[model samples]
Target: MEVQSAGKETYRAKTSKGEATRQKLLDVAEEIFGAKGYFHTSVVDITQRAGVAQGTFYVYFPGKQHIFRELVEELSHNLRREIQIAVNGAAGRKEKEIRGFAAFFDYVRKHRNLYRIVQEAEFVDPALYKWYYRRLAEGYVKGLQEAMDRGEFRRLDPEAVAYCLMGMGEFLGMRWVLWEKKDVPEEAFRAAMELIMGGLEKRD
Candidate 1:
């Protein structure tokens, strides 16, 4: 029994170490991929940049494509979480929409590299792009649907509304964070949200 327990502990330790190594590789890979792009980055580049063995990279990620996919998925997850937090904290539909937009734009500004990677993935891999957009669209749809159900917003197709909102957010994020060399001010995002919700809000 003692030997079995000790062996399990050793396995767990090794597993944890492997996961750490994998994450390190991914971190470096994301940086390089974002700077150099998916087509230009190689496994050797990641391993060298990450200070890990080439074989180690293969163990965690099959290749550059796999790493790109993982990066996209991770970014998507983070974006979703940020938006959810912002929306959940708001007191009303208008506030929720503003908060959601703020959270997304803030995230993009702070994580510009990751955002660029996401944009590249959209062009390089259609399937991954679809998956990313689907998740984003679903989040927006749910938020709009909630507002409509609460009688806080006018009647409309949640999915369509969500897409429009997301499109506007995406373009704003890209312009201020990705293409333009500056931080997006909070007021800018707030104004954009106001414009979007201006026509959509339910009048008392």
Candidate 2:
């Protein structure tokens, strides 16, 4: 449970309206930050676009950087939640990997600003930028390790494999969803799955 701190006072949305206002601010910030870039975006810009007073902004986020950081954290949380849900319904290790990749592409398609905002974070907040991917990779490593334990995947370094998978998904999303404004094509998806399964499937 995260609370918004304004000076000495801690602000938690006490009502539905209050929570809606806070969420509105975040939603507007995501659009502005993605379009204008962090350095160029201002608190006034966010407040005006959100149709909220400048003081209201402080009630939720202390400043611009706080909102930006919160946005990144929110994206990370939602992404992992979506991927986990999809992977959970999968029948086996191969299905889990395919489902996870599909979930990621779908997420990227929905959140078109994802790449822009994340890339800007490298300069906006270095630790947070790294934390985003590291958190994602943590989930990947855990799942890969489980598959290895079950002998579904060969015993290679889970962390290394996690990063490799992340890189592949990231670029594929960038190439297809972000650039082409479409889902990853069936041919490309099948090829990637074949390449991954070929490498990971256990042998006698």
Candidate 3:
């Protein structure tokens, strides 16, 4: 939905073919940007790998930076949305937290490029990099606040709690998924959940 164009018209893919081409470019760009640092990649590289004319890339994204920004935004949106869906129908805050971590690991396994691309955004566009995490943390903080109000979690600083949990999940995913090339082991998941559950859950 964050499509943009160089021209005043503001481009969008109106047909099936057009949409497919645009998606192809984004998919290829994700791989290219991940394998090669964003600073090293070019529009020509994306178009070549995507099997589309350079002009076709322009039809969807105005420039390399535009596509990178949009891709990061799209990734952030998808991650948050998936977490929301996974945590749905959970009976309690602890269950929601457990399911959310599972969903995150599942997503990372499928989109391994996300870790590289997100890190590169700090150099490519610092604002977009911050926006990505801030957007995710906003939802996390909201969830924490709700749990606190429900007496499920202790009354802690929601923002601090949000960052703590995010850091834990990020590192866990980085260690097991990105580095190990496998889903986090069941023992590791249980250990982490126990740590988080102890730290946040109310005693009484």
Q: Best lDDT goes to which candidate?
A: 2
The clash number for model 3 is: 0
Off by over 4 Å in 2: 1-10
- Give the alpha carbon lDDT tens digit for every residue of 98-195 in model 1: 77877887888767786678778777777777778887898788878888999989989889988888888888878887788566666877678778
- lDDT for each of the candidates? 0.78, 0.89, 0.89
| Candidate scoring better on lDDT of 2 and 3 | 2
Tell me the tens digit of each residue's lDDT in model 2 across 50-130. Answer: 999999898888789888888888888899999999998689999999999999999999888998999998999887888
**Model 1 misplaced stretches (Cα beyond 4 Å):** 1-14
Which pairs clash in model 3?
none
Query: Which regions of candidate 3 fall more than 4 Å away from where they truly are?
Result: 1-10
Each model's TM-score, in the order given?
Answer: 0.86, 0.94, 0.94
lDDT of 3 by residue, 65-129 (tens): 88888788778889999999999999999899999999999999989999999999888888788
Candidate 2, lDDT over the whole model: 0.89
